[model samples]
Target chain A: MSDKPESLTQADESALMQLREEIDRLDTEILALISKRANCAMKVAEVKMKASGNAGAVFYRPEREAQVLTSVMDRNPGPLGNEDMAKLFREIMSACLALEKPMEVAYLGPEGTFTQQAALKHFGQWVKTKPMPAIDEVFREVEAGACNYGVVPVENSSEGIVNHTLDTFITSNIKICGEVELRIHHHLLAGPNTKHDKISRIYSHQQSLAQCRKWLDAHMPHAERIAVSSNAEAAKRVQGEWNSAAIAGELAASLYDLEIVESKIEDSPDNSTRFLIIGTEQVGPSSEDKTSLVVSMRNEPGALYHLLKPFNEFGVDMTRLETRPSMTGNWTYVFFIDFAGHCEDESAIKVINAIRETAVDVKVLGSYPKGVL
Target chain B: MSDKPESLTQADESALMQLREEIDRLDTEILALISKRANCAMKVAEVKMKASGNAGAVFYRPEREAQVLTSVMDRNPGPLGNEDMAKLFREIMSACLALEKPMEVAYLGPEGTFTQQAALKHFGQWVKTKPMPAIDEVFREVEAGACNYGVVPVENSSEGIVNHTLDTFITSNIKICGEVELRIHHHLLAGPNTKHDKISRIYSHQQSLAQCRKWLDAHMPHAERIAVSSNAEAAKRVQGEWNSAAIAGELAASLYDLEIVESKIEDSPDNSTRFLIIGTEQVGPSSEDKTSLVVSMRNEPGALYHLLKPFNEFGVDMTRLETRPSMTGNWTYVFFIDFAGHCEDESAIKVINAIRETAVDVKVLGSYPKGVL
Candidate 1:
């Protein structure tokens, strides 16, 4: 009876070992397949660039990705759900894009800022990153051959347009290459050696703290909050203090050797930030594209009405409109408008000429392919 | 001479007072105009809803917004730049939306989570919010009439798809009512009394720590990292201990009476999150709209090929596709897809039916009006 039991245990152990070996083999095969798939994506990017006359155009299609994911889910067999399969593909595609082009991107930053996040998402890990102190610096970097492109915040879903970026666009020669939209999450962090009980000070960027005003009012009515130059700077200051902490992102925690004392601490979960990619080179034709331009008008009562008449008559779709104070004149303005359709298109050119007749200055910022992600 | 100086100072003070009064009057007029504009928007929303046969349809147009901003910038007599004027109008429109209908929202949290930040962005301050314990709970609450909608994380730009929310959608009856995107920032927070050097531990949700892994590895090399249920819980725990800190949002600083030790501590400055608003209600048409659906297939070769053939043939544009394993049957799969165009459109219906012919089960999640933002 004892021998029989021992034999059974041995059989079970062998079976388990065999299962492990099979899993390992499958994993290796999967890795190889993924690498090959990525290589194929690079080839596709090359083909797309050649077809469109742009060398670095992103070729991945969101619609196509959706189709691939759907197929994978249809073939999936097990505990892992369809979303899981689709997620795996999404990462794989991201990695593939990174491999296709090591994008060099510039963004407004001290690092660990939301603008940096946008750069990463739009360009992926394949790109090298350069941090600029100001929005204009980002533009300069892209324009001066220091980077392939620049990412700058144009608007926040909650706070509205980032005027600095828009203003920079009015004067800078850089074109609107692409756009990436990101969701914003803010967290509070502190250094490792600090004690929670004796804390008396808090530090963060003014905007970071302001977004959580309601939560602050309810929980920490007495703590003194100090504004810092940037969230990264705040993280730097909290290095050795026990009572003081800073509101920042994950980058700050890692950069400052601090620990995350909290997570996903933003007051609203749906907060999103939209950014524009500025580059000297125009993007190739995409199945879907958006064009941006600036139209300046003399300060007059009906100038605005007359300027918009072209769009209405021509049936042009405009996406965004912003104003910048005219640099050369007092009490005059320049209008920055983003609309659907390429500048190369006949109707677009017609509309531009018509608007120019009614406006003092008109410049095409750039017309490029729209980002699907 | 003494009288002249006094009179000059008095005149300056009077001018300042007059300027303040004028500014106040302008603000009042602007407010009135905003109110009138919002009232007009409500009427438009009403007309759109009546036309589309859906009650909660979004009528605000992104292209229209672009045009409005451009017009405002063109007509401005400034000190304020074009971008500044557009930003002001963006906020005004956002506030106007709030007046049309105060959005009701639910998020996964005790509080101080990233999702909360996203929710605030989509609905703004005017909306009513309720926090739920889990993502599914949020879905359930929205489904069961506890809230009008729920905001749940769908994907992260870096970490990829939030599997839990997507998996829940597979079986749930709720539809994706809307979406909000956010940029995530993490912070280190501690109580007011703790010393920085005495802090020995850090706490946050597991995902946040993962996102900030590079920053933590470089900075807090010696500290022990701890994961909690949420950033809010971490904040709550830090209130009783002087030696501990929480990694959370600005809300955590106020909620637990803690001080910010660091701010903007994310690995990527552009760290943005995308969330879906789930509800029982369906969305209506706008200038643009997107539709989502699910299909299940038997374990057969070429099943997917046949399913997708219709889309290509009929010229229906699909945006996203994802796969999930079939829970009811072994070796079977389910596919989730998003496409441009409404289900009511002729081409869309034909493609959908063709896909249904090859798939064992087909379900329409819902057709939604696309976001213009």
Candidate 2:
């Protein structure tokens, strides 16, 4: 939406106005379609609730949602990329899902954290998100039916794995329902009253400080860098300090009424974090799916090798394998593994069975769609 | 060491005093032994410099240090556990190594981060630690030979992998020299002047707040929780706020002059983070070692399955496998894999060669000693 060009002739201006009007008309039709979709979703909830006697009707079908997203991207002949097109549909579908059932998602948060962002991105802004103090609390909130689902950080491209999340899975019966990945962008922000040249201090989380080290060193060499707990808190601190600025995100900038001093200051452009959507009920297979499993192995020589052989034999694509010390044995370890395909698939079933032959225990976490956005 | 028991008789008191004297005498002998070790280290450095014509004298040998630490634990007839005994010798070796060459280490830091703790834990307190604001800076500092080694957080048990660290490896030539794991403990702290009943706000990094959710819910539910950038920053913020408390670590508490209101308040007892030591030089094989590799594969139907076949066939214990989008390709992925045994091992070599037969490219990140603490 560019402003009317000053060099445009009267005829061209009239043509531009007509184009704008046409866009407005298309927007109206789009709004009507969205309303129709929402109404259709409410009917879906009614049918589901009535069919299940209003007991435990699972409105959120991972496979179904994945199918919808896949079709949206596949069918899109867009001016935008497939990902951008799918994301627009993602929000539409999320709103529709909420109409079917208002999802209360518990996320690891104090608000404005990357995990919260992932929750909204996955569930859409319509679902109510409650900030839980810890990963396990998010699990407990969902387990106790206080929330329908939970979102927690599972891995980062840089960080290996969230050990606590994996550990929680070992003891808790919570199932992995879905997944989302969020690109992390850190911005340098300050209060409006602060003079850019006079800024003497910078506040950010330790990782943020590290992520933006070169930028800070080159741009604000004199500022005393203060590592805070969260970027949101750093933005909060800057609100009360004239000589201080914050390294945070757009969310925190708006949340704390801060101005962006410098944007996208992270050292690596590829920095992104992956979050897991967890719930009690199992997720059905999506078009492109991934299955998570926790396998415990006795402390025998070549234990890890034996546990992974099934995937190689069955041509199953293994995505991730993280080792954690098992709680039950002296020197035993458990492997948190993620492999392609749903558990119900023949190859996946065969692989799991084969792993179980040598493994002390093999617990299927869940099979969920691979992240759409 | 404990004080004399209150009910001790005259003879018992004398025996206790004698034991204390003996301990004091042993400590003096230990000091002499440490001094002797330092002198030996200095001599070793001199010999290395002379042999290499002072062009490059590698004073710090990861494998050698690992061997020493292993022997220390193995020979320990301990009232202390193997880990505790090894830690004591770790500090001793650190001091001795410092005497050989004053190693300057760079780490992701704003001074009081867990990353700094991991750096100190891995390198010992004797080396001068320089806090770099970013992970890549830590890598660059080492790469540029500004620092002897660099430490960065590779993963958190609760949060997963640090993507920037891994991404940096793809473009940078920094070597993984060693690995260390630190158990994370979050404490509720406040300024000395802050009244316990008047803690209207609680500050911490988002992760810490999540980690300590249960403790806060049970203890201070009414307080407003604020997420900051780092726990140290939270501790720093609480120093001037009479009505605020911060959840941080012991380092943050002392660094910011805060009093601990509660200790070890994380939701999960197993909360920990793993850090990587990056340097310019390759490390030789240690008794217990792990090799890291970055393998890029073509976008094939069963690319992941084919990659794992070698590890399975060679009976290599695959510990970790993380997938990241390839930088050069639209849909291709690069796997950051970790497995038991050094690159020099016969099985590891066979596996690497087998993988090379099918994989587009494989880059050996490093083979380093597994974390001892």
Candidate 3:
């Protein structure tokens, strides 16, 4: 109706104004409905917490949220597409969950790191954030009740598992309450004073620099590369320097007042990072869920196959399988497997028992509702 | 030796130089081994392609890379922590993959958009890149064979599926060969000459601005928010204006010579986008894999349960289950499921047949191997 090309015909203009007024009115109604929906989510969170017997259970259900948003999007109509509509609801739910119980989460410091991003995605703005200097510190904070939960990088789509996270799991008593997967995008950031000709050095967390290996090789082959503790830290060091740049996330650029010399500088465009949320409680079951376990096997050629045989025989599906070196023995390894089905299911229980009998040690890393996103 | 204190009387400058040379020599040897290892991956890729019938199979495997890097970290005595060590290996492998095969992919244009970043992560620098004006154009380019593959946003870990992508899937025969999930970080960028106080409008893709909802509410509550087609387009529009600022990716900032006024502006730090790699042929099995399918259910009270009964009874695991509006009928829905096995597996085939019998129609979208990341 607004597309009519008449040069402000009096009748057309008034009709257009009236239609706009009606749209504004409907938008206000939608805002109210959205507020109501958020409030309902708070109630849902409260019920979930009471049922699960865990105060922090309200946050981080990747699988559940995925299902919820999918249903919402399926039923949505009009100018807004399903994705657009779902995004609006995701924010609403995030805000609602925040209201249910505010959480405090800790991650490796400073800010704008992928780990920090993962924590936010899982917990939303409802949680307060504490940036720790190290992964161990994040664990300690959660263990000491300084934060409700801790987030640490477990793996990257391009780089693989963050070994520190896996090693920490081997030692820490903290449960893997939840997990969040994030896509990692690295940028080459420099200070406003930096001149392309004067640039001679690049700084970043070794991971960031590594992810952009090819880009560096092709574009800045002569520049010296230095590694730092975190991408944010690298950006901080490069601030006001004309001869240096830092490879980091956009947040680092803003946090350190740096300018982007280049963006999405990672070696691969589809790079992603997966993080684990450590806390004191296990997640209760939803309509769908996933269970993670760590199994140790003797140093033998067929040991890995023997452990996996039962899963195949029982028709249990394994989603993710990775082997980490066992700290206790030479050449020994701990295999971490994520499979469908809650631990409470009969088939899941049978498979776990079977694997446990064949393996030296089996650690159930906690069974949580799978995240939707 | 590098960590030895100067307390040793024999520790001299020349001794340090000699030690540095030795370390450098070892590094060269390590580089050669890495190069050799990378070459082997091409052979492995060849085997995989022959087995799976996909031409572009040689790429970085996140899980295997993680496992290998974790081993190195665990074995290190550590002047560097495990995190640092693993990070270095991640880059090494990423570089190796770049050598094996360069990829070229297409995404919605212009440069500095998150989709561009997503394309980079999946294809790396091994392939050429082409930017399309619309989502449909991306598919058309891939269809016309202008690019080997196309990367388009399928879903967000937090926000749900991109409906445009889903709608495209409905009409197009392109198979989803692989999937990449990326974490998105948005920034408020301005020209160096732009004054923060004078900024009157903020321009960005509507989706990006929405992702930063909370931040905008808290900071620029009154600033006029304008929607554009893409982040790069927003950046392009703000080139000479001192009163206008753009919220976009770091690439946009650099591409347009804009200063980042605020970074990591997304409400949740862990904002991630998931993309699908569309190609003519289905992907082959990897050491790690996931299979996606779409099944239609009759509109009944317990239709979902009936449809899922086969998976449960057959002990098949469903990783993801999403419902979409069916175009053929009113109130009927199509379910998208991601499971743990390739469609070729005996049990998977049985389950597919059973699901088809129970549902009105079942479309096996593609049963490709799961991503290693």
Candidate 4:
């Protein structure tokens, strides 16, 4: 493919071809802008290191990220929605962050799990991500300072909450530094040797299995349904046998070089999952931010009212609140809350202090920028 | 296995055998009690049928079920925890309910998904559970009167929220009648014909794959990781293959009759998921109740603050408050909330009325009993 624009024949100069030339010119400009942004990121890293007085510097800034994304959405004059535009910028920032410092992330994984997809989505492909089998190990690796940060699924719109991640915060001091949201789409896949009509078994993760329950029952009611660790693993298994198929996502389908027998097989068209970023230090305020905390209270009338009154009085917006069985004692309960505004915000601080006054104990999980994409 | 009272010499009876006899007697007594309970349920059904003026009647009572579970916990005096005691009673209550009217439940499934286990855990095996492929279909079946209720996952503690279920509620008028929490434990499984020493591939759901990433990296670093729909499906595929293993739960391993090469292989010890029950009618007050709702507000600063002020003023304790992207429009947001009392309660009514006064629109999902098991 030659880069020279040597030909301008009459046919090549048609209106459609002329429009294509403009599109190609715009693409060239976009690439140049990206390269320039990367160089700027390197300079930004240098400034951060000089300010911190060391080569080992904290270059990632959650507040700044929030501000950037919010600004992009606020000013977008586009055919695309704010979320779509923000997603495009998200990749740009991810690449820039890689230049500043290649982030090392630990996530619950076997390479093809949704958690891994979340890691890549949040940090981009530039980060070095290690998959830990358990959520606790992700916390451990982050806790031991082996990884810069850890990613864990905190909730699913369909599934409710991941108690393990919340429970981890009860015993560990990891900060909630960022958040990611992933759209869950399941696919029915098979290997090269498989006989499509003779497929006798299908495998997938529990959530995926549930997501595709309708499709499977209609197409392969008699096939053995097996719940595996991840969709990627299922795709791998089908490779060895002729009568097996897997229901996984795009990653797994590609990871195993499998064929997609069916796509978008999940029951809900809008299935999505939210994940959290955990680290040691707390984050500051952004244009819009969310702070999470866990609070415990004794069983009594108005106990919950007492815990929430301060936020109401302080006019702090509550984003999410959930109850979990208290790990410390019987007949005791704990609540996990997420609200708009960083913990460093004045109103949030007041509400937090007020909660501490009535709560048996309170842990400020962290304040992070809202999920922009 | 003959049960006969044989002569036992003073020194002939071992402590274990003596204790076993006592346990056997208790079990017999328990069976008698259960039989009596079942008979009472039959009489209750007859009364309900008479009251309804026919043999056909709706027998499941979410409020009454909650009250019974609460009472069981209150009166429990044993070495076992309240939760443990309530679990045993949950099954008993489920059995009794079956005698009155067998319940039919729809869940996201392929037989061995966690949602299936949750359905059984909440309703007991006496109820007929139809595995539907999608969360929406579960709602559809219940709405169409094909099933008494639908059990769809609303959230997971570790995973945060299930967006599809929440969004479905936005469109469909299903009431949240009850909830169930399940502890998730994953295991490594293999078929009998597999060569244990030379495993080159692994299969599992994406989440489970991530959950066991570290273990696999350490043990089988070279094995190709594959993602699947469900662990049960993975196990099924492994049954016919010799060089593969699946990571799934105990249910899948048993259902597929696979050998457990590793048990409790998940990294986190307390990974659990929470699920919600959806039905047509709103449940009344229970011994321990939680009410869920949805409210929309205008896009403005402190929109969330205005919505929560009433709950605080009325002294209503909100158990949960989550923000959802409004399905109706851009920039507008909605909140899903769970609180301490039924909508019929005095304080809760005040809060609801106050919220209605300012909010653009509101929908009360339901008020049901807190999960006792």
Candidate 5:
């Protein structure tokens, strides 16, 4: 029953010390390269500001960043997988971007929402993120120049689209600067004083509650399920409650000083959400990109058929097509479409031209780099 | 100014009495007609039971109900709008259906969720509704025959699809008996003694907070937004809190004994959610119907374009097409497609068969009557 540490042989200890020293040497080289990259980014910022003749120059180029990440993944000769290697480069790039210009991002929040998680994932930890009360406020923040850019959830693999985000685009002139997708993983968390057996209630966002419905039902059926505005808020509420748990993420657990009761409780293994990085500047193509458009079509028998024909004819790959009631008239509808390719591509131009001929109106929301992480 | 009432004259009083008498007579006739309808429904149930050779008869027919509502709307000649008139019939039909069978429904709830409201709206107030903690439990309830049917949100006009509901369909064999669309309206409510100016916190579901983001920012900019499981849950939490308000629906307000501080506070005027009714029995076509399908596509160039071409060629009007990552492999996707026709229709069959030629798999989620109310 004795708990004693086993001592290593003198020869083994020497080998371990050598390995540690070698790791430290590699870290030193990596640090030097990261510093050099940051210095280069600062120089690029100065040139951009001078060329634009103003301090309000755009430093966070999504297309450029996407290309960098793509190249990192493509050329990775890794013991680590491509995604893991690119993630390390992603942080390095984010630090460099911050050096170019300190960026502030606004997101739908009461802090630990998946939107905030997506923002940090996309921009890296270097950028400051502000939690807006609403999706529109996120847009307003970017549009009003209060924040450099805003991040909003556009769609969820399990929950569907965030209609408010799309509707906000119809009224606001903000461009879709980039796209990022984050896999949603929910955790059951509780404060330190909480008795696991005495848990009487569970709190979460309505969607989160729905996402973890099966796990909750199977494990804690008697515990009352309370829907909240955000998972972070749920964690915050549970922080002061002794007999309750919150279904949030690891970030929320860390943020609220809670312990994980259960992890990755979402019903679907591939549950994920797609977020849009909205800003004033339109993003260029990164070779691989997507274009989103809002198209208002005539109320006719074959309106949808005609609207989709150009994509088929031009061989453009459509990722999504969603219908919403048009603001102009009753029974009239508008379609929100996402397709592969930059809007400026030759085939894209022809497709847009053909759609405009038949559609009542077509507004390209933006063409931006596809999500890299 | 004088605080005096203008009394009616003797002639006016006599006219009012005559009108009241006439209204009472009309009410009697309406009651008799309702009774006759209920009697007819009971007889229909008996016939179905006898045909099935047991009491476990499928008494509720969503397609039949849709037809009844459609005819009631189409043939109505009144001061009330078509929707209003059909609503009255909906209640009547609900009452008649109850007489045939005391249907029990399971739904995602702790009581005042939009899902519960949708269930009541579709099934009417007569059927008993049991609130389930999760979406899968609702399916389980119906599958286990604990409840005759279940109601779950499928998609939102603004929020997007309820991925849990769709994912639940992947493993569950429940048939989508019908669909019901409800216009979502949120209210800012508080306990009667709460001071509006002193309110420091607002409670609601995350989506509700997003939906009412603009209204809250414009009115209660300084309040801390709290996310909860459901709007009803928010209303319940706000009931005893003097310094807090809740964003909820009229149903939650009434259920929780709260007063509306503001009405219809959602940001989008046309904000709505679509719900699906799940049962063991399949629904026949109501002439006007929609079919939902889950199609898994191969990872190839123009896979989407090829999948959509058949729908266009067959003239099967596609309403929605949503993509989600497939469970089978990386980079593979499955689409949830909704089109304006039953699965049995010639055009729909042509389209489905054509799609089967290229798609990896296609599962007919259901061919249910379109939402009539």
Candidate 6:
């Protein structure tokens, strides 16, 4: 559409307008295609509901979505990178999925948090999201069928593991349906009432404070740094105080109608978080899948060494192992493992069997498709 | 010392007083033992200095520390679990290690963040601590030898991975020296000038807001929730306002002279975080050790499968695999893997060799001692 010759004279002015018109026409065509796709998804949902004999049916197929995302990335003839291309497709699919059955996702929230961002990034904007107070509440809502799924932060590269979520997995029967990662960026925000020059205090979550430590030390040395529960809460606090500023992300700043005094205040640009989708139904294997497990071993020397023997013997590719305190057994630690292959895979099953033989206990948290966005 | 005869009612009072005296005596004995231990560590440091021909020497031995922690847990004969026992011993060792050279450590900080807590927990109160603004700076400080060691959060169970730290690993040559875990707790606090009845807004980090969502919804539903940079920052902000309350941890509350209005506000009782110790030198194998690596492969179908083959072949207990954008490659994803056994172990070396044969590139992110606290 942008096929105008370079170094053209005034004669090309009319042609430039024509090119823009061509772009507009193509955009309309794209919208038409999207509407058609959304219709197709609704039609598919009808079939799925009929198959299950009810309205409450598993409309979100992790495997199918994963396959679609993989296909999109594989086939993209993009000027953009594969991951970015996949992300665009993910949103399109998410919108179409919403047309079929709007997803109800529960997330850890007092409105704005990284977990909420992860949820939107993974599920897209078309779905209905409810903020749950805690990680456990997110799990419980999904388990009790209040929401189709729940989003929760599982670990942070800088923070290590969320032990509460790991502990929840020990007792809950919820499945891990999908996963998403979001890059974290913190900003320094202030309210409409605040005198910027007289700003004597700063508010933020502990992580954000740590993240922006150098920036604050250099720019606002006299400002007393205060820790809060979250960035969103900090944005709210600034609304009532003129001599106060809050360090948060774009989400909280926008949510509280605060102005960014400084942007990207996070010390490290690589700050990112990962979130998991928890649901009641077991997700089928995707083209490239990952399985999570909580494995327990007897308290003895070499127990950890022995517990992991099965993966090697059975050729199962283990991905992650986290040690959390076991609740009922003298506080011995349990390992949370993520590995390649789904639970239903033949090799994965064999590995599970081998682990069960020697391990004190084992729980397959879920097998979910790898993150495509 | 607690063993006084148990049957007589009136005599039990005297026995109880005797028990109290015994506890005091035991405490003094413990202080003396700790002093002696510190002296021993100092003597070792002197000997090391002599061995190294003066000023600078490698006084911190990760392998030795890991072994000591492991032994402490193994030999613990108590109602206190292995973790509690290890934690107590961890502080003891940290104190002793500090006496050797008064270890200088840097962490993401404003003093009250969990990273700071982790630093103190890992290095003991005797060490000289500094706060870095970002995870990368923590790495840089250690790389530049400006600090003896740097502590950063690598992953969180609830939030997944801190990509910034992982990204730092991709470019920096800093070694992973040790790991520590800390349980997290959040509290709602107000300062002296705060109006308890007129708190129309609550402030916290986004994570903390989410952690306490349910409680806020029920108790202070009308209070506008705001997010901030850190919980500590929120505490400071609340001090200058009467209509605001901040949610933070105990450390933050005390640091800014705030009183806790509500305690244990987190939704999950098991909230916790993990931190990593980064230093310049490669860590030797500990009694029970773990190693981490950043592995790259040609972007292809089943690339992950091929990449993980080595761990299975060598029976190395693979623990973690995080995918991040490869710094110099064609923007394909790279995997960060953590597994049982240190880099020096024969089996671990075999796994590394096998991986090297197939991998496009591999970076040995220094092996470290497991978390003792």
In candidate 6, which residue ranges exceed 4 Å CA deviation?
A1-9, A157-159, A187-267, B1-373
For candidate 6, write residues A168-275 as lDDT tens digits.
988889888899888766788898677788999999888788989999988999999998877768888998889999998665665577877887878788888888
Residue lDDT tens for model 4, B142-205: 9998998889887753245888888898888888889998877678888877777888889987
Weakest 10 consecutive residues of candidate 4 chain B by summed lDDT: B1-10
Candidate 1 residue runs with Cα over 4 Å from true position:
A1-102, A108-113, A132-134, A156-162, A188-210, A220-263, A312-317, A340-351, A368-371, B1-373
Q: Which ten residues in a row have the lowest lDDT in candidate 4 chain A?
A: A1-10
Worst 10 residues of 5 chain A by lDDT: A1-10
CA-RMSD of model 6? 30.3
Task: Score chain B of each candidate by TM-score.
Answer: 0.65, 0.81, 0.67, 0.77, 0.82, 0.77
Tens-place lDDT digits, model 2, residues A1-373: 0122123456545654554354334333333344445555565556556655677777776676677768666654433345644554555566667656778999986544678768877876557887676789999999999999999999853234677898999999999989999887778989989999999999987877887888888999999999886666788899999999999876567557787787788888977889999988877666898999999999999998898888999999999888888888876789999999989899999999999999889999998889987
DockQ, each predicted model: 0.01, 0.01, 0.01, 0.01, 0.01, 0.01
Single out the weakest 10-residue window by summed lDDT for candidate 6 chain A: A1-10
By lDDT, is 4 or 5 better?
5
Scanning candidate 1 chain A in windows of ten residues, the lowest lDDT window is: A1-10
Cα miss at A220, model 2 (Å)? 17
Alpha carbon deviation, residue B268, candidate 1 (Å): 28
Per-residue lDDT of candidate 5, residues B61-134 (tens digit): 78767876786566554333456445555655666677667799998764446777788788875678876768
lDDT of 4: 0.74
Error at B202, model 6, angstroms: 20
Candidate 3 structure, TM-score to reference: 0.44
lDDT of 3 by residue, B17-100 (tens): 454344334323333343344445455445445544564443443334434544555564433344434433444444445555
Superposed Cα deviation of residue B201, candidate 3 (Å): 44
TM score of chain A per candidate? 0.65, 0.81, 0.75, 0.77, 0.82, 0.79
TM-score of candidate 5 on Cα atoms, chains taken together: 0.46
